[model samples]
Target: MVYCGPLSKACLPCRRRKLRCDLRTDACTQCTRAQLTCSGYRDTTALRFRHETNAVQQRVTARKSTTTIPRSPPLSIYCQARDIFYHNYVFGPSKPFEFLLSVYSQTSKDVHLSRSVDAVALAYLNAQRPSGSAELEARRSYVSALQYTSRALQEPHLAKQDSTILAILLLDLYEKITTRAPAFHGAWATHLDGALALVKLRGDEQFIEPSIRGMLIRLSTNVLISCVTSRRPVLDDLVSLRHTIAAHSLTPPDPKWRESDLVIEFAKLRHNIDTRVLADENEVTFALIELDSKFLELSRQVPPTWQYVTIQVATKSIHHYESHHHIHPAEHVCQMWNTFRATRILLNELVRSRCMDRQGRVNAGSGFQGIHERATRAIKQMATDICASLPQYIHGPSTFDLTGSPSASSDLGSGTFPAGRPDPRYHLPCYRLIYPLFVAAQSSVVPPSLSKWVVDQLRFMADYHAIKNAMTVANLLESGQRTDVGKVYAMLGSYAFVC
Candidate 1:
């Protein structure tokens, strides 16, 4: 026997119960109190090694695999949708949505913001994969968002919060993505109306915060577009918000903000003509001339960096539309040019249609002939420019198969692109093109050949992007129903400002 160490000084009863012992000669106090036999402590002289080598070998054997297979935790549906939402809308290639970066950072802590984001994200995903359970989840989240937003609105402290307003805006986007037909546009319009009310409730103080001020500007643009499509007057509140933003800012406004001002001017002028508030055709023509010149000035005022090079591709090339497509320095610049072209096309059409006499002849006046001739040229040229911008979008990487072979004849627009869906990054450029392309295709002045190409692009968007709204508008255009631009605008309205 080898003496290792001292045994416990306590009696067995005390040690068994985990209590200290007095080690009385007759019996320990703990044993006496329990009336139990004291199991004597072990003799320190008797010590032995008891462990076998097998345990150590077994432990080491468990670690002897060829390699460690790393595992990543699966992300929840909500997290996946949130990431997709931010990628396409907040961080995507559109200038109007860049402001969202300031607000989305706070989303995690706020239920309304997070749920609203989830709603839109899931709805957008469902738009691409209509058969998924994401649609059901999207509806649930949307209702939850609506309930939370309503509760927030009742509290004055929460009503004007940036997250609250952003939730409302996102709910609007959810409506746009999930609703298939333009007939349900009232769903989104109701959201915008609620957002405008919330915006007005903030008063002039809303401009103090940069994030809230940006939301105000974006909301104003949306409202103005709504007014333009609906033939309603530009709201006095939108004008007030614009002036307040300008008054609060220290530096000069950027070119995009100036574009908003121009849009406001057009919206107001449109209202006046429709309501016949300006009964004088001469006065309307004068306003048109002034607005046209202002637009021309804006075109010149944009920075050289914003300008794009127009690349001329060969007619035989698959990328060729009207024998050319634009190569914008960035995606946002491409979107802006399309916007400018669309607006100019619509404005010039107004010039051609409104500046006519009862007999349908151009009214003789100062700058009328020049503006009229320019309007004719501008309509055709702007429409063509809008068409020219299509190939860059239609021929994107995901739009073509790896082998570049056409699919079966039974497949419609499916074989044109790879079977694998690209990331959400590729989605927005095509989405942003829809409204502008629709505007171009709808114009009477656009040559039938170019208009046909634009329609084909919309058809491609429907098949390739899985966008039902695009298909709806494409069918309407092919049907030759040009009566209500508002109906067509409704289909793609949500995409117009954001992604």
Candidate 2:
């Protein structure tokens, strides 16, 4: 066993456990009793990496400038989707969940910010100004953050004082400042505060850990806030019920709110609160759904047998934000969820043998493949659970539900959706939906063999539904763009694709 500065890699007995090597040695007395054979130490390499990475990172201090080094990871086709998600963490999607969740992991690498694969994060971040056309400004910031996140994933590093995920959180907060996704300014501000508070709990648990849970808390908080702004009483009630529903307190025979009341109250509130807030929340949810879908599609789309170019092209795609991560309130979040889950399974089963899922390691068929498999299983479970739970929020009279109404969707202006008053159920715990997905590999397990993700892709192929029309002409320009043409569209002429 080797002695590291403050951390020890392993004892003699532990070394043998590459297949459960009971790493124990005379140096590690406890390991010996356990019949373990501790072997060589390796944790030092990470520490050394941390020291050098920091000295290198010191060039951009938080106070001086929060700029990060940009990076484009070596993506296989399957992981190509990650390229977009990585950047989206920094710039796209009015609200970023996985991006925020991965914050703690940012410090370990340079690509999180300083580096750039395509000058995307830098271009977008530089575009951020305190005051500007609200929509355009927000879109700019979202684009920058997305690029930054992807680069970070590509270039893995370890910061001395912070965990990689924590760094990701802080960076996410920084990116959130750019979100104008309807009503997320307040949401971003509130989430930043919560993210800061999670540092103390970073080590207390194993399952998803408290810091991870704290991240989930911020996401859930964002969801609750969005519902409140959704101008939909039922959605609001669902938002409120989120935490309570978890306790099973809201599911009684009589329940806190019943169906007829749910319907009537939603109808009453449809003409009240400012639509901007509702529209914004609608937009935020849409971004999240898109992020989730993209993640599933890419994760699966990148075949284990996928070509390097396929992955490269996809990686480049992450840097390409076709437009703002905007979403329509009328879109259905649940409709495509199962399809995503099934697709994730199909893709993962094919590529499970490849992903590193860890930092600074080659994606080869080794012990890490097990972790990759776990990641896929995690996505499947998460998608399944989130989809199952989301309908509770939708079933209520919130404006998105057209089940019993005239025309199903009302064309209220920019923000209004069923323009209604606030209600109770809209506050349900929707954020709890993705909570356990990113836990330490130590605790995550493959679903019991019985759990299967079976979806009839054919079932989702129809009209395809409007779902979310987030792409704006500006997105078209920013995607591979140069000039801002109109207040709405960035560039009107030639595309990088054709060239």
Candidate 3:
């Protein structure tokens, strides 16, 4: 029998028997006859000493430190993932994440797919998923990977190789299902299949989990919002599932989070949905974005001033993914250029008419004057930063942030050439990105301040007259330019700052 009411200072069986006595975990001497899985009685005062601990351990252990696979990835894919991870930013995809997913689906399976220790197939599958045809392909690929992973887990003789592969697969699953990207049917279906397979994967009876099931639940909550935001499918079911997961997660080991990163992401997603969805009692969308950029404390309160939700989500998502599992170092230089171009488009497309006109008022604050100066400065900084992060062989400077990359690329986005290149004090990569971000970040009170900073930064770059080839940030500020950011942004170091 189970007791639901508050028990006085009663022993185990007394509470179990509905007659109050002492309190404990093991059975009290008096209630052996009650016959139950009796717990002991505890003093009320001891409740104040609340403490929590986790017994779950990190399952990954690199045996020889590195397990080398016979076949490697293409230069393009490697570079793209490396770049994005290093940069720590990405909004969307240049070629549509879906297109990338389609190509990856074909590339990673079959030859790459192994039921062994190699997991390039799983890694590739979880990395990108766009939509429709591409989504289908990606989903299929993920399912294949999951099956292979399960087969490894099922072996009565779980070898080191199998253990390594299975663990890696689980981590990849965790990242794939949890992280936000351009969602499509492919990723969703793949994830759902993986989830189901998780329950059955042992080929026998065994345990399976993704990241933490709790985190997965929280991530699914975000995925639901992703689907809703992207207008995908199953909104009602998705929501119901999230509630069910949350309710279950609150039991047992309970939902746990560290450093608050997961919570912050959840808050961001909730806010996105709150703004997009209509009134519903079960709505889990809402949160506050603190200014420190650390996503301090999240409140469940979602504001009505969410007109900018879509844009904010796009920008932040781009940044977040770009810096992680998305693009390569070489790819990033180009991506940075592309981002600048997007920034220009955003400004020009959104407010072109507001600021400028068929008449000529557009000239007033159209970034025509010395605005390019700021653009130039921003470009120089971004290029230098990009180069420093990459390896000398490919491209990248040496000063890349330590929290950067997975820590293994040798030669990447370094500005210096394997052939020949001028010193930084002389010529530099295109500096046009600065003007664009400035323009993007610009507000009524920010433009002039931005312009001043640009000028100051340019002054720091060196004499515009000395570096004949170097483009000034002010140049980007110019109203008229046929500059297509895609084409012109070939290399991070060869832009407005480059001559």
Candidate 4:
């Protein structure tokens, strides 16, 4: 056996297999002889010395002391912006941040995606600090992102790449977060259109990568929400993709809520309702009835651990509000229940609206009257349930002393509460409740008192959380109440619903 002094120059496959190789210019002899592909040699210059002889080490230290080795250039503004984007926008509970980070890290050489990250990061910073310099920088980054994206799109192969799609999605998020005015709402939609086009071009087979799957799912979710809010027809491709994902179990059930599946089911049903005019009325009705049955089945499938059964405690106060429930259910349980109730409201509303008489009155003999009544009752009950759940959300445990005792003192002030007790307005779950509250507030059957309470909660969210959307929802609900036009979708207009 001819001995090679070192295996460092051998082809990757030969080195891995511990085989001798004649390291040719292109393919190695050993790899060819073995009928294996040679992956080529690694860069020898990139190898680092972990340990060295004393004399060599001394010489190296002396050289370093005598002449400073040029350090790599500091990270550019764009690079810094990308980091900020990951930390501030990308790394979150809802996002698969680690997987996305890995994907981004692997594709660091992709200029389109890098520029998009910079653009989104700059836009996010500008949104936080709306200054001339920040705006200018953001604009520059945005232009760069657009240019790179356009270049990528021009290439037939590159346009369908995951990196290209991600760039477009990032741009969409940038437009959504930075564009404050209603006039620029269509800007996000345009990017969404571009992303959808790319997704169509790539097809389902390209989504084998987990990161790609996650991104496509998020994009579909955004599109679904937009369709629901705008009363637009859901795309056939999106529906197909959703079913594919569900079938493949690409989106795993969340342990906390397990609501993703239910949400998708509801979205499909809602889409059917939205485009029902195009289908046979009887077929649509039958489909909806079947969907309702499925929903009922799903309701029963809720994990026993997730189910919140309230136990009422007697209190001294005369008011019913003085009675407290002892159950301290998970925040996700409340969120899931609210989602389920909201979906029911939408389904029942569709049935009720379809069964309405020419004068906009529900037909008593159409069997829709009973459905409407049940939905209305459910909405009110859900609203009350949400109101009751407030204590759990606010206090972290359902230990509210409704009898006006000293235990209630912890909830009194705004930000002055001790370490463990934060203001309810600033609680994370409060922000999440906007959709459910809005749904409840829009119900004609909700009592004025309950409606006012919902509005007050929204106001708190707007005031404390600085959520402009909360204020918008509050105003819309108020307008709807005054005008007797309580349709949420009608009032939403250009404002995209996030939740």
Candidate 4 Cα RMSD (Å): 21.1
Residue 483 in candidate 1 has what lDDT?
46
Tens-digit lDDT string for candidate 1 (312-409):
53332433455555666667677667777878887888888765678988777566677778788988888778776665566352332323322242
Stretches > 4 Å off in candidate 2: 1-209, 213-336, 340-400, 404-499
Q: Between prediction 1 and prediction 3, which has the larger TM-score?
A: 1
Could you say which candidate leads in TM-score?
A: 1
Across 1-499, the per-residue lDDT of candidate 2 in tens digits comes to 2233564466534545433433343336555566554455565566643435565457646546755657877554223323443544434322334434444233435443332222333323322212233334335444665566544434424321233334344444444332334333344434333433333333333224433443444434333323333333333333433333333332332211222222233223332323433344334333333434555444344332221110111121111111111111321233123223433443343234234335734366444456555656655564444333332332232432222221244322122233343232221122111111111111213342211111111111111111111123213322433321111111110110000
lDDT of 3 by residue, 1-499 (tens): 2223442566545665677554444566556665655566657555534443221222233433466657875555334433442222112221112122222232444322332112322233223322244334444555665675556545534422323233333334333433333323454445443433443333321212322343334334344433433434434444444444445553432112221223334434444444665334223211211211222221122122211111111121111212221222333243333333333232223222233346844345434333334334443443333322222111223222333442243222332213443233212222332334333323222344434444333432324222321234335433334443322222222221211
The C-alpha TM-scores of every prediction are 0.75, 0.19, 0.26, 0.65
For model 4, residues 1-499, the per-residue Cα lDDT tens digits are 2222332767788878888878798699888888888898766544433334676779988988999679999876655566655653356333423345755763588888887777777765554435566567878878998899899989988888878877877776666556544322365655666677778777668667666667777777666655555444556766776666665564556532245555555566666655664376546555655666666677787777667666464442211222443243455566667667676666655655665678988776656767656656655665666665554444333334434232554442232333442453233445566766777668776788777767766775566555566788888777764432223433332122132
Q: Provide the overall lDDT of each model, using Cα atoms, as 2-decimal numbers.
A: 0.71, 0.33, 0.34, 0.60
What TM-score should be assigned to candidate 3? Answer: 0.26
Of the pair 1 and 2, which is ahead by TM-score?
1
- Rank candidates by lDDT, best first: 1, 4, 3, 2
Give candidate 4's whole-model lDDT. 0.60
Candidate of highest lDDT: 1
